[model samples]
Target: MSRGFLPRQHGAWAMLLIPFLFGMFAAKPVWQHALLFLGWLLAYLFVYAFLQWVRTGQIRLYGRPLLLYGALLMPTGAALLWLEPGLWPLVPLFIPLFLVNCYYARRNRERSLLNDLAAVVQFSLIVFAAYELGGGSDWRLAAALFAFSVLYFTGSVFYVKTMIREKHNVKYYWVSVGYHLALLALAAICYPPGLLLPLAVLLVRAIWSPRAKLTVKQSGMLEIAYSLLITCSVLLVYAV
Candidate 1:
């Protein structure tokens, strides 16, 4: 019933969906990838519930029951190992990130820039996982997805910090703007065509959104629109 029982962060859901979709679209999906997607979804749900439990110290809402349900769902994910035993090696990769998430949740610093960057890295792993699941063998392509995800989400961290947490903090505000501009330049130089729309949209948000006196709900709506634009732009670039 509580929002914590579901994915509360729309931005995070966008991050999760875009890379997974990008990888799937980039490669050929197999039957096992369905299991992989399911497992990944359940894993995130469990992590969200667990983090909420840790942060609020309330077991009744997001505690044992949700934890138990999430743990039970993981076996289905583990079953993916049977489909492609190669997935076994990648299992342990997420453990350290889980530990880090737990640490941040405990300290109530889950939104800190460092934590956001760590999450960007962690969630970006989905691109690699999806690549492997969808029968993609090109490490280079997977790496590219990871890089774009990092750039986009890092910008997201700065955007949120500037707009909500530190709006009046002029130093961080400019830093966010500068980072967005640098990223735009880098994208233009490296992968100009594919990244054009997404980076341009990000630059606009980095410059304008933080200064707007939008309420929380309005800002959330705007973020959803931006997320969709970025997601669609990436999909379109690859589709072409």
Candidate 2:
């Protein structure tokens, strides 16, 4: 059962995820933001506790990595509150990936999906907060960030469906990721200063994920899409 399990679980998780992302993305340098940061930390702790409760209802976890996360996160929260939005976006990221590993070990696929969804949410929040801190509202940059979110979310959905719709070929995973990378890279190549966001996207993808292989057809489609995006980008550049 591939994504047959996903539909069963996505709705409940989405309700929680939406608010978390909302809070994260809405981050700015307000004096009142400290209180909100405390709230976010509380939320993060609650989620971790919930995941643990689900994993082991008995509640006895003295894991080294968990201790490590707390050590890292305490300092990180300090940095973010001190106006280090650049690094803060990534802190929430560490927790989810650890959760993802737990999910994989348990063979609970829905948990992994939630992890990816959570990742995009955090990364988008980073982009939003980072840009705002850099200057006043740049709606154009926000739009581009949204576009990147759309592409990533859509790619993630399609990749899951492709796994379900086509059978359990995990290679399609890389295909969708590669599709996303190609699009971002082309965007960077076509537009100057476009590289930053794309590079961020690429870095997140490259660093956080384990390597996976794709099939010929998957590779071919990505290549075609990359070529097409490049061609259209060039045409638009010339037209402008």
Best by lDDT: 1
TM-score for each candidate, following the candidate numbering:
0.91, 0.38
Candidate 2: tens digits of C-alpha lDDT, residues 153-231: 5454445444344334457656666766776676666445534453454434432332334564664455345334432
Best TM-score among the predictions, by candidate number: 1
lDDT of each residue in 1-240, candidate 1, tens digit only: 555577667778877777788787777777777787788777788888888888889888777658665776868866777777867777787788778888999999888777788788788888878888878888887787778878888888899888888999999999999999999898888663867877888898888888888888999998898888877887777634
RMSD of each: 1.9, 12.4
Q: Runs in model 1 with CA error above 4 Å?
A: none
Per-prediction tally of clashes? 0, 0
Clashing pairs in 2: none
Residue pairs with backbone overlap in model 1 = none
Relative to the true structure, candidate 2 reaches a TM of 0.38
